[model samples]
Target chain A: MDLFEYQGKEQLRKFEVPVPEGRVATTADEAAEAARGLGGRVVVKAQVQVGGRGKAGGIKLASSPDEAKDVAGQILGMDIKGHTVKRVLVERAGDIVSEYYVAFLLDRSERNYLGMMSAKGGVDIEEVAETDPDAIARVHIDPLLGISDFHARKLVFGAGIEPRARKGAIAMIPKLYNAFVGLDASLVEVNPLILTGDDRVVALDAKVTLDESAEYRHPTFAELKSAHEVPEQERLAKEKGLNFIKLDGDVGIIGNGAGLVMSTLDVVKAAGGEPANFLDVGGGAGAELLSNALEVITSDKGVKAVLVNIFGGITRCDLVAEGIIDAFDRLNMQVPVVVRLDGTNAEQGRKMLQEAPNERLIPAETMLGAAEKAVELAHGGGA
Target chain B: MSILIGTDTKLVVQGLTGREGSFHGKRNRDYGTDLVAGVTPGKSGEDVDGVPIFDTVAEAVAETGANTSMVFVPPRFGADAILESADAGIEVIIAITENIPAMDMARTVNYIRTRGNGTSLIGPNCPGVISPGKANVGIIPGEICEPGPVGLVSRSGTLTYQIVHELTQRGIGQSTCVGIGGDPIPGSNFIDILEKFEADPDTDMVALVGEIGGDAEERAAEFVKEKMTKPVVAYIAGVTAPPGKRMGHAGAIISGSKGTAEAKMEALGAAGIRVGRNPTEVAEIVQELRG
Candidate 1:
């Protein structure tokens, strides 16, 4: 899950990284009050989880609390790349002598954590690596040994940054690395590590993506949920403990595994139908879980038909069929339903569904057949 | 005759006393796999599904002479379980546990490589590998597959089954089908399985099922272009997936155009391979190759 800019700074502060004094404000008055507390001068930045905030005029420098309020009024609620800015971060303006870049991220190809630091800052690091690769010093830390002073010094010398920033680079680079490791974060980037007049390097901005699977470990990460960013159906799915991603089509898909769900989506499209969403009931999904998955999918207004494609492995098709039957009883589902059951206990499951014979349900013999039926039903096709 | 597992595969399951472990363990045995022993800490001297349970992999390996390990443990200790099996001299470990923190996987991957004794891992989050009509390892349905000559490798579970069933229905049975798992850092990669499929006499052609995310598919395409002689048909999923959103698979996210489905598809097409638009199309390509 990607944290908002302010939340990223808060996480970095937890790692004892020095960040400029800041407060989150939802309104112009709150922005003024926050700026007043920060020497009556602040930087009003939008608290959306997207890039190019400055280019979009979501960031503004104010000389006084009055100016801060005006800037906040303009930036707040502004849509930046489809993300609505509900809050603004009012931070004390830092005295910047120079800007540097640093980040620690999981490298999928390398199968290791990569540490990247560059003397050029306040821009996309990928662009820098593209335009001038030598400017960015990239290092791969051994997963077992982790980062140390030697690695820090290597980045310091390789990036060709100024000498005074070297001390902070040595101290701060590993601290950022620790944050990445300690938090089980996939990525932690400080784009502009600014050097102040007092010879101190502080993080001016932060972008952190915590591993969602590691949410079981860090309970406090719950508060950083981007509820506004996630749609209502997705919010409901998360609450129901289902892996569901809402789409823009008419066919609601429910499958046992992620890959199966994805394939079901493709097959729906291949059958001349668009998928409403991708929903995986996950392993060992019983009647209640499948019912919850069905409820979540049916709740979407765009869903004209629902396809339950389950390839039982650890999950039994009989149990899944029972769940669908039970769910049909509990919920008022208006959409045309297509059920395809295969794998373990499939014959029993198919027999059970056939015996009940709900009018809303259409049982197909094969995966492709099921997709075709669902698609035909979705596009105003006959029963 | 198969690359990873065959009639000689004596399997010991880790976390055997657990619900999933006991369930799939019995399923593996029911499919005619040589069920050997099980490892469940502190549950030694007990029996799960008539299989002897040992407290450690060392004891299980010592008693059962099992060459392979199927891990179905919780994510928290999943890496440790894999390390234990590797340390105990299990050659191929198929980890079925998902949500193992990526860092833990990175560490185990490096550890296995540095301290290599021919230890190979398939997945910490895969469907395991199946040699049709010979042995069943993880959770792939053993009934749907037919023993023949087509070699299948994929990064998904149910999609692997779907494609294999498509191939089987079209009279194109497979020698072995391997789901290398959907994790970003899988234990075995496309090249590893492709190399095996190329060398195995029982296998004649190959089907590569991939998804957007990571450079594994692109790298595999390069490998196929350079070294492989077998006719390879490929299918990449998540073609309609949004740029930033991860669709189901943890490794199935499009990373800034680097791991897009189009990129993987183009690379495979440029490598003189038939890239299918869907699973059925891929089966057709394999059918034509069979001719």
Candidate 2:
């Protein structure tokens, strides 16, 4: 959901904010061309989802197009916090007199959308929170009333915008709020919102996370969606209409419901095995859903072994076991599937699975035991 | 006494013409819940599970005198459904849909607060509540629960079943076990139900099963520390989950210091709530507190 700096800036420009001209580059040659387009004095920033790119050598300042190419060559294909560098944002560098931070997020307890602003910027918000929480001005927007001009003025002054820049900052607040709400964004952030030496304000960096749940309303947002942003297996699962989230480690997981999937993930990890994914088959996950889920997990090249953990209360465990058996038969599974069934007719469910063919159907007494068995099997030990 | 639904409570099912709504509506009726009416736009003349279907919540409530509504509306229109039900003066609204946008929830929750009127909301993503031996109003399989003095509350549905199974294995019984749903915004909170548990003399002890997420557990811990006399035992799942990846609960992501399992456990422990490391140990903690 983390947009590239150029993408963020494009969205900002749509809101009529001042931004340095920029273009995203994929290769060293492209970076050089982009730098030339920006008048040959530009900033090369690695296009990764994470922050602290500057500290990680992902951001470099170049005085000439050749220097931009050199810096982009060093950054291209390099890993920044586990995200591969696929693109770089080359922009005209700005002469800043001051930098500030501004963002909007949901505050659950207050049940309101809160706008947060700080005079200090270009650093992680966590640092600001830890060192001086009071430096951040928090403004809650009542949903009924929405964000008003008064609220914007309050936030502008509270964020310590100087007298000269105060009017401009206040004017931008409502536009930013409109963008945040109009885009169905979970987050709309402007980091290092710089005040140019000429008394003009420009957004130097931007990060926006769109709310996926509202994608149904905005058809155009679908073009911006990239499956590569999430786990590979989960992307396929989403394509198949299954809810899946990939985690680190060896144990492949398929459970019913989000809560159960999470608890199963915890139990598997607690038993010293990492969960490969969070796959919830939802309520009444029939044989089709189960088969689709298993196929999705087995398709993953990273998954070593599979764990079929079902605490079937409303959805019958026996049905889930049958689905696993059907999926195993359909796919001719190579990896071991450790089954743990506990709930209504659980013994019957286990008995049903026990009736399936012997080689891939491994049974364990407890969830912990099942996870241990799966991890061990995946690690190359005999089942 | 249950925190929300009981056998004595008159029930109405919104979106009752839908497959899930009709299925659960009939099932709840068969389970002894007084399913008095149903609400589905343009299906007003129909009868679902022998209950009259009305066009609106107001019509249903007025005709059937049903104050409790179990909403099965689809996620896109769920907020409007709940707000409509609330506007109609339904005392409690339990929404069983999943994946409601956080922004939509914030607006709905904020609307309720501003209007100074809100029917209790159980979940946009939850298993609902079961007042054992009384009535069940949710997606949770009812056969797993039994009526007794232990009031059980959890964020995980299957984990709730597992915890109840463990408790039942140890000869403990539950009075009313509520699944508050694992979404970031739930209709009711841990503190909302804990107050009812504190007031119920039949409930001798309370078991709270929380997961890594928002500060709900911390707030609950503070409530139990200040208000409750009965013993409170708790457990937080996904302790080993990686920080950035959501461990399935939409609200379970560890953001800063608030949503980590360690933070939740520390807050609960600091508030004097006996914290269990796993669901298997939840029953043991409750039993020890019973002593």
Candidate 3:
């Protein structure tokens, strides 16, 4: 789950990391009011979960409340790439001595948490990595020991941070680490960890991606979930606790496991058909779940055919078949349906599904056969 | 004759009194595995499917002489359960729990590695391993597999079954099929299983199943080229899968140019392994190799 910049900053403040005072404003008047509270001068930043916002003219320097309102008016409606700015973050403008980069992330290469620091900030780290790899200092910290003073000192000295600000940098590194650990974040970055003219270290920008698997612990993060960012079908799927993602085709796919569902999507595409959505009914798909799944798929106007693929292990195929039959009985679904049953009690499930004399129901003996049938049905076969 | 588990493997099912635990415990036993005991913290006096339960893994191992641990616990205690099993001297443990926090996995994986005990873990979200007709350890159905010379390894559960089923139907039997889990960081990689397959005398050919996410397959391809002598047919899933979205598996996403199907296929093909476009096609490739 990616966090908007303001939310990331708010999280940083919660961990006692020094940050510029900021307020999120949704309108021009709100921006002006926020600037007034911050003593007039401010930086109006578009609060979208995309990069290069500064290059997109989504960020502006406002010297007065009137300029803040004008800049907010310009930014709130601007689209940075595909994400439209519905809100602008108004921050108190700062005086900087230097800008430095710092981030703590779950590194795939190390298969561990990595603490990266660089004296060069406010620029893409990838550029620094490519042009001069030595500019960035990366240290993989054992999750057990955590971020230590020694680790911070090593990072600061290694990144070539000036000796004068090393003490403040040392003090700030562990705070960011605490936020990363406390929030169960996969990534927490403070690019442009600014040194004000008074030698105070403050995070000027933040980007965070929290682990959704850790949602059981952090209920507060629920407020950060953007409903509008999700498509209607996807939002509905989330509401129903279904793993569903909308795609652009006519065939609706339902499968038991993620890998199987993914393979099903590929197979359908290979057979010259596009999938309407990706749906993993998962382990415990019963009658109600199946009914709900069918309703969700049929609700999509682009879906012309629904394919139910089951490879039961812990999941019984007969129950799935019963669910499919129950779904047909409950929902007024008009699309053609293709069913493929395998694994536990698959024969019984296939028999149950075959006994259904519904003209729209088609059963394939193999997974590949099922894909071909679903594709064939989606192309021209009608109810 | 195979890797991971065989006739001598004694099993302890953690969280055995719980729903998934007790059920897969029965299924594991019914499939002719030597499931000696179960551990459910406080359910020590209880019996699940005639397997005696213990309060802790140590007691379970001490009494039942269990050497392998299979976990079916909730996401919260999954890492603890794996660690407990490892600390109790189980060398081979498989975790079937999904949605475990990545940080939990990172901490636990580091612990498992630094412990200096050569304990091998298969998954935190995998189907486990099956040594066809010999012993079934985790949840891979014993029915679909056959005792042949071909070995199989996958990062998926159902897709592993799909490929194994294809092999069985086409008379291309397997020596062992292992699911290494599809998490961002699984306990085992394709190289671990490949090295085992290459060493096993009974295994003559290998079928490798991989998906988007991580450089495990590419690294495994490198290993295959360097060490393995047997014919290895490969299948990479999520070809049509879009970037940035996880295609079912936590580890099955293309981050930037890495973990892409095109890249994995290219690496595997360059290593001289025939890369199949789909499961059935992979089976055909294996059939031709065996023939």
Candidate 4:
């Protein structure tokens, strides 16, 4: 569950981390007004989960209210890294004496929480790791001991913060760590964890990715979920309790099992077309889920074609095929659906699909062939 | 002849008073496993499918002398079940519950590692270990399995069955098949099971099933490259999976530019592990490797 920049900043503020005063604005006038409230020097940052927003002109500096309005106008309708800028975070620009990156993630091999802090934090951590590997400092936290003052101090010092700011960095570490565990975050990142000219440490930017598995414990957080920010198809899928995440491509996919769905995605890419969404119906998913899934994919205006890949085990392939046929009938879907069904009763499923009256329901012999057919149909081929 | 369960393996069911427990427990008993006793806290002297339910795993182990356990406890209480069974000196334990919290798993896995006292755990979300024609444990569909020499290890439960069914269709019977569960932190890893397959003379070749998360497959590939003399055929699922969206299991999320199907496949390929494109290909690859 990726939080918008404004939401992440709000979480940081709760932990007493100094973030620039900001307000989210949906319109240019609102952004201009927010900039005026911030005394005119502000930054307009497009709110999207994807990175490289700065390079894509999603981040703009405004020296005056009018400039803020102009910047917002330019950004509001612009596409940044394939995501449209629907909302912009208008924040009072701060002085950055230095920038650093800090994040926490689970290290499976170590079987503990991993704390990574880098002197070079403003850019992608991947770039930092690839180019200047020595710039990043990695620390493993023992679950038993948890994060301690000493550990925090060592990490801060190791990240190469100046001696003068080391104490403040140490002070901020525990606060960030507390927010991470308290908020059930899979990733709590402060990219460009800034040092202001006033000798104050502030989180200039926040990118938090929460763990949905811990949703049962955080009811308030569940309410804070921003489905409006997600793509239209995925938002609808979520409402129906279907697991869906929209991608950038045109081929829509629905499958059972995480592994199978992913493998299906690869097959699509291998077949010379990009996938538009990854939808998993899960094991033991019945007609209702299947119907919702197909509706979710076919409803996508960007989807040129659809693919259903199932390796039925406990859930029978024949039942899934029945659901697909029923969904096609109920919705009167016009788009092409290429299905690749295997495992128990798969042959029966293929026969059922083949006998279906709809010409759009094409059954493929294998995953690769299914992907190829989906790609072909997506390119406006087939009956 | 199997790594975990076989004819000599005496097994008991945990949370046997529950419906799922009784159901799978009955299946294990009917499959001719040495289903000796059961454990359900404060359910002592109760009978579940004619299996005596004890108050705790210690009592069950003491009475039945069962050295192996198949756990069907709910997610919340799963950690305690594993600890209890481990404390009872069980040789092998398999947990079949899904969605055990990360924090709970971290603590439980750490404890199991430190205090396992030579005990081995198969899963917290997996279909338990099965030795065809000998014993059955966990929730794997038994109809797909037949006693033979090929070994199978997987993360996805249903996919494991699909691969096994395909294998069975091709007259390829399994030696010992284990599901390591899809959770990020599983009890047993690929290396743990691979070592068993490597050492078992009955096992001719191993079929490895992986998914689009973590470096588990890469590690397994490393294991196959450096140590194993027998052939390894690997298939990583979820190539079409969207980045960063975890639908099936919490631990199955793609994070930090790693754990992609492409990455896992490339790693496995570099290690000389024959990568199967689909479930049906797994058996064919293993067959080629066996020769």
lDDT for B107 in candidate 3 is 89
Residue range A45-78, candidate 2, lDDT tens digits: 9988877788999999999999999999999988
Interface RMSD of each: 1.5, 2.1, 1.5, 2.6
Comparing 1 with 4 on DockQ, the higher-scoring candidate is 1
**Model 1 lDDT per residue over A235-311, tens place:** 89988889988788999999988877877888788788999998998877888999999999988888999999988
Model 4: CA > 4 A from native: A27-40, A62-74, A247-253, A267-276, A300-309, A333-383, B10-25, B34-46, B71-74, B239-248, B253-257
Best by the DockQ measure: 3
Ranking by DockQ: 3, 2, 1, 4
Order of candidate numbers by lDDT, starting with the best: 1, 3, 4, 2
* Candidate 4 lDDT by residue in tens digits, A38-130: 995899999887888998999999999999999999999788766787899999998889888888876676667888888786888887898
Model 1 spans with C-alpha error above 4 angstroms? A129-135, A162-164, A197-199, A226-230
TM-score of 1: 0.95
TM-score of each: 0.95, 0.94, 0.94, 0.88
